[model samples]
Target: MASEGLHAPRERLTEKTLNLHHAIVSLTEELDAVDWYRQRADDCDDAQLKAILLHNMREEMEHAVMVLEWLRRNDTDFAGMLKEYLYTEGDIAHHED
Candidate 1:
């Protein structure tokens, strides 16, 4: 006996797409968390806390840029991503350390 549907080729393309989507979502969540920390840093009076928060915010923006590039290459909405990136960067920079 020969396998019919059992031997059907797996949907590797779909799997990869799902994995990419998951990655983007995770990165977005991380960016949001970083933004929150940045906002918290604004309220912090301690210089050390402000410095750490600013550093983390910078790192998060870098990650966001990387993800945005990936999304652009993947034929995502580049304009929207660019707009969001700019907005987030501005928000992160609002408080000077």
Candidate 2:
């Protein structure tokens, strides 16, 4: 059987591909956690609990960014795209022009 999320046989994949898959999965989970935490915090009535949930959400965001940075460092495409799109002024959709 293949590893949990693999679309192809694990034996057919390269070591680098497996590592990238791991990073991608971790990043997805982290972002999902952030969204879930934010939703729960929004519905929470207790101030202290809400604060704690929001704090946890931010931590998840940090984890996601760390994973993204790993991808950026390891993949030239990610590095190029991030450089082109991130932290720029004006209309984002027009950046390609």
Candidate 3:
């Protein structure tokens, strides 16, 4: 079956590209879920439900991070960028220039 949000014909894509597509799509969905849960938590009046929503949002963030790690592992460019940009104390934008 064809994957969602594919910009080109599936037949034209290699297996590696397809797998990356899947990971990117999954990352997008997880990030979106995190946003949604955050909004819901903010709007919630019930403390317990708000806590649940916030907890779910954190889980979604974890999922997004895992997908990012997968991308870093599978793609050299991503690995390089992550190494350059992640966990550094100095100005981040300076690295881009």
lDDT, candidates in the order shown: 0.69, 0.94, 0.94
Q: lDDT tens digits, residues 4-95, model 3?
A: 78889889999989999999999999999999999999999999999999999999999999999999999998999899889988788786
For candidate 2, give the lDDT: 0.94
Candidate 3: pairs in clash: none
State residue 75's C-alpha deviation in candidate 1, in Å: 2.7
Candidate 1 C-alpha lDDT tens digits along 1-97? 2212223354544665655665577577778978887998998999999999989888888887777677666645665656556546445544344
TM-scores of the candidates are 0.57, 0.93, 0.92
- The TM-score-based order of candidates, best leading, equals 2, 3, 1
The C-alpha stretches of model 2 lying farther than 4 A from their native spots are none
- Which numbered prediction scores highest in TM-score against the true structure? 2
- Pitting candidate 2 against candidate 3, the one with the higher TM-score is 2
Model 1 TM-score on a 0 to 1 scale = 0.57
Weakest lDDT window of 10 consecutive positions for candidate 2: 1-10
